[model samples]
Target: MTDPATLSAAEAARRIRDGRLSATALTEALLDRIATREPGIRAFVHLDPALALRQAEAVDRAAKAGRVGPLAGLAFGVKDVLDTADQPSQYGSPIWAGHRPRTDAACVALARRAGAVILGKTVTTEFATRHPGPTANPHNPGHTPGGSSSGSAAGAAAGFFHAGFGTQTAGSIIRPAAYCGAVGFKPSFGTLHRAGMKVMSESLDTIGIITRSVGDAAFAMAGLTGGDYGDPEARPGRAPRLGLCWGPTAEQAAPETREAIERVAAAAARAGAEIVPIEMPEPVAAGLAAHALVMNGESADALAWELDHAPALLSPGLRERMEWGRDQPRAAKEAGRAAFATARAAVASVMADVDAILTPSAPGEAPEGLGWTGDPAFNSLWTLLHLPCVTVPVGTGARGLPLGAQIVTAFGRDGEALAWAEWVRQAAVA
Candidate 1:
């Protein structure tokens, strides 16, 4: 029998609901796994064994009473930036250290309502920006696990949780997941509630999920959508018409990464999907540039209080970013906004002919250091376009590290993105 802690959320939930497995037993297994792995991975920042046990007991009670929810008896990790009433919501900066929110974030509340236990708070980068955390990759402890959602990705990969919360202003979710060998799904902008989440860039800070498989991701997305502050975009029904995209950034991808995309696309094509070659449009190319400005300016504004009051606590990289945002010319900011609108329209025009596009999840496998998270170059454009994307692991790289390929659907077509991703994953295995 598979270890209960190692089971995917979908499988674990089923067994718990059938009374084949008790929530208490499952939770104990997961907690034990975390205890064993947390020392080296440093994936969790705040873990309350008692709180998790209590939550598990509640789920067991509900299950025995025949009142199980979709995620009953499963555990999900929360990024430190997301508020947790019982845990400190320290946004990965010394300034907010030990700060606890009076209420859970909207997403957390929904997860609890669906019967999943909030396992712990995962480590995040400083303000979910350039600053790296102490988390090490679960695959290779010497290398980085990527950021700023490093811990959530590593935690999911290490089986500390079935699925975990992540956020991507750039490649925070995908890059980390790719590096850690997990499925990372970034829903269409505003698809998940962000009310109690730490804000970086309003335009690009999308809530996301990290899971072991696309099916688990789907289960989570199904339950997380339709919250008070969520974007209830209708998912289209049909086999996806996918376009193969390439650009200047594509050239920067490691040979292994490029090969992985080609392999996955070929497999999907052989499986009856239409694959068209598409170039990065000019406006979309320009929007990628604007992404940096929008993120920098907004991050500066969002963390202005800390910049002003706690200069000593701010990281050098973050301090520089804030200062640059503070000094940006009005024209630059406006140009970024204009560029975004144009690129958004251009991408939509092209999407009319296709359900989604295939792209690289990262530059390559996780880089060989813990000092920095790998580049977000491949993920920026789609994020800027507000498209929903899912990164599925297609194969391993030269070093045995996982390589992922992205499936990106038009804005508001999250279901298409996820469905196509699951298809591609299945095809790869076949």
Candidate 2:
């Protein structure tokens, strides 16, 4: 039998429902795996084995009673930025260390209610900003796992959890999942409620899921939002028309990323997908700059209390950025907002002829060293435009690090986005 710890969430759910595997057994396997692997990976900041087991036990009993929720038997890691009533949510800062919320974040509460066991709080960059945590890539400990969803992605890849809750202001979810060789699903803006989360950039922040497979991500989302994300394995009657968009970040892509895109395009073409080269509209391309301005400005405001009261506890890099954001001209911030509005309106035209856009999930592979997470140039445009984006591991880079291909669809088209991403995943493997 396959190791329960290594099973995808969809597979685990099926096994549990069929009485072939108990939720307790699966939870124990994951706990054992964490015990053996967590020291080197450092993917989690808080873990309560007893609590996890209790949840699993309850799930097992519910399954026996034929009253299981949609996510029964699945275990997930919550990003530290999200509130978890049972666990400390320090937001990766010493200032809020030992802080526990009175209620779970909406996403956490929904997941738990849907029968998913909370594994623990994963590390995040300070306030989900630039400063990274201690998490090292599971594939290469010497390399950095991308952030600020660092531990969520790493934990998903390391088998510590079947899925992870991640948020992306820029590329927090997709980039980290790419680096860690997992599937990242950043749905359309507001797809998942964000109440109780540490809000950074209100306009750009999006809650997402990180899973080992595209199907697992889709399954989790369907359970969480009660939306029809569709079956990942479902095939469309006609071949998909994919836009091969390099966007404005083409210049920033590493050779490996460029190669991965071309390789995936060719494979997709062979699989009957129409790969049409399309240029992003100027306004949408301009979102790269707008994203930076809006993110920094809003983040500064969001952390006003920390900046004023406990500035000493914040990281130097984050502190500097926050201070810069706090001092930005009001007009400059408004212009940035205008740019996003224009871009959001223009993106529809860009995708009018294509079912989805195929692009790079990150610059290349996970960069060496943990100090700087890789650039989010390839991902920010989509985030700013409020499009649905998903990344699947396509291949590996020169250093044996993983590389991923991003699939993006128009706003509110999450079901299609996930379906197309799964298609890309299948083509890459075929």
Candidate 3:
């Protein structure tokens, strides 16, 4: 029999549905893998083996009763920032140690309804911000796993789960996945339900997923999307007509990242995609600062209680950011909102001629050391514009760490982003 942990979510679901694989057996395989690798990787913050077994057994029984949902036998890792009724959700902060919610986050509920076995809570950076987690890159423990959603990406890359839930406030999802060589999909803002998710920045926070392949990502997302929390404007359609952009930020990215982007574009063009080079508009470029301003401002207000009561427990980096946010003039926040609106409009106008935009996922591979997660300069602009973005691993960098390129679409065009991302992945490997 194939090692169940090695199978993709789509494959596991199909096998379970066909009765070729038992949920308990699959769950045990993954659990065993986790036990073996987790000590070195530290991908999870909370793991309940007995509970996972019980869920798998229940799924097996449900299958026998002909009551299985689409994801009947798949396993998933939930980011700690996401509330989980069955496990502790500490949000990677000492202040919230042992915190558990009364209910699952909306995305978690949807996965459970789809019959997925909840494996564990993956480690997250402090409050899903710059503060690093213990999760080391699965490819090389000496290097960092991109922060915020560090464990979700590391766990997926390590084959601990078929897929995992992650959230991106800035580059949380994309950066980590790029670092860990996993496929990260941050849907159009509000495409996935955010209810019960710890709010970092309401304007920038986006729920996403991490998987080994684009197909697995699509499979997981199909079941998790569509709830009262998602925007109605995010609709599915078409293969992408891509407009490639290597903006001013490109200069800051490593040559390897630039090479990855160029490779993906060439591959897409070879695959018959209409790829064109374009420049970033000035207003949209200004939105980068707007993104930081809005995120910091909102986060400070959101964590006012913690800032006031337990500031000592917060990481120095986070504390500084919160303090800065609190001191910012209200006019700065307003200017950020206006800047984002202008940038969003600029993006929309440009999209009239293309289905999606392509860019580098991060500056480069995951950096050495856990003290700092790589920069989010490449990702924040899109987050500010409220566009959908997917980072597909293209190849390895000079250090042999994974490299990725991003596919982005105007706000609410998540389907287009995913379609093009899958296309690019397919073309690259073809």
Best by TM-score: 2
Order of all candidates by lDDT, from best down to worst?
A: 2, 3, 1
- Candidate 2 lDDT over 256-292, as tens digits, reads 9999999999999999999999887788767677787
lDDT of residue 359 for candidate 1: 88
Error of 1 at 158 (Å): 1.2
Off by over 4 Å in 2: none
**Backbone clash count for every predicted candidate, in the order shown:** 0, 0, 0
Over 4 Å off, model 1: 226-240
Ranking by TM-score: 2, 3, 1
Q: State the lDDT of candidate 3 residue by residue for 1-430, as single tens digits.
A: 5788788777789899999999999999999999999999999999999999999999999999998788887999999999999999899999999887899999999999999999999999999998888999999999999988999999999999988899988899999999999999898888887999999888889999999887788778876653222221233343457899977587888988888888888888887888888888798888786788899999999999999999999988889999999999999998998898888888787877887888999998899988888999788888877788889888999999999888888776676677777777777777
What TM-score would candidate 3 get against the native? Answer: 0.95
Q: Score every model by TM-score.
A: 0.95, 0.98, 0.95
TM-score of candidate 2 relative to the true fold: 0.98
Task: Please report how far candidate 1 places residue 410 from its true position, in Å.
Answer: 1.0
lDDT for each of the candidates?
Answer: 0.86, 0.92, 0.87
Query: How does candidate 1 fare on TM-score?
Result: 0.95
Q: What is the lDDT of residue 403 in candidate 3?
A: 93
